[model samples]
Target: MEVLVNNKLYAVQQGITIAALLQFIQLSAHKGIAVAVNNQVVPKTAWDQQQVEPADNITIIRATQGG
Candidate 1:
């Protein structure tokens, strides 16, 4: 299956969870990170239960601190 992550195309396993996608892309699951699926913000507590579907528009963002 394929999904768009941050406007980029990514091929992932079928029924890939949000948590798994983060791991597949080598991103650490920590603070300052946020994920939204199809314009809906998914809570961190539900990442493991959120399953990504084909053609799903996923946006992964990180909070940066700067003066």
Candidate 2:
């Protein structure tokens, strides 16, 4: 299956969860991050349950320490 992540197309396995996707892309889940699917913010508690569908739009925003 393919999904649009941050406007880029990525091929991922079907039934992949947000948590798995993050790991697949080598993102640091330990850090503060925000995930949104199809314009809806997905709470951290739901990452393990949020499944990515084909053509779904996923946005990952990681917190930065600059001000």
Candidate 3:
């Protein structure tokens, strides 16, 4: 299945969870990270439970330390 990640298309396994996708992208579930699916923000605690559907729009935002 293919899903949009930060506006880029990525091929991922079927029924992959947001947490899994983050890991696959080498991103940790650390502080200052936000994820939204289809324009809706998903809570950090729900990352593992929310499955990524095909063609779903996923947005990942991370905070930086630089001013």
Candidate 1's residue-wise lDDT over 15-43, tens digit each?
98999999999886557999999999999
lDDT of 2 by residue, 3-34 (tens): 99898899999999999999988884547889
Q: Supply the TM-score for candidate 1.
A: 0.94
> Can you list the residue pairs that collide in candidate 3?
none
- lDDT of candidate 3 at residue 40, scale 0 to 100: 98
lDDT of 3: 0.92
**Candidate 3: segments with Cα more than 4 A from true spot:** none
Kindly report which residue stretches of model 2 are placed more than 4 angstroms away from their true locations once superposed: none
State the displacement of the C-alpha of residue 19, model 2, in Å, after optimal TM-score superposition: 0.1
Regions more than 4 Å wrong, model 1: none
For residue 18, give model 3's deviation from the true position in Å: 0.3
Better of 1 and 3 by TM-score: 1
Model 2: pairs clashing at backbone N, Cα or C within 3 Å: none
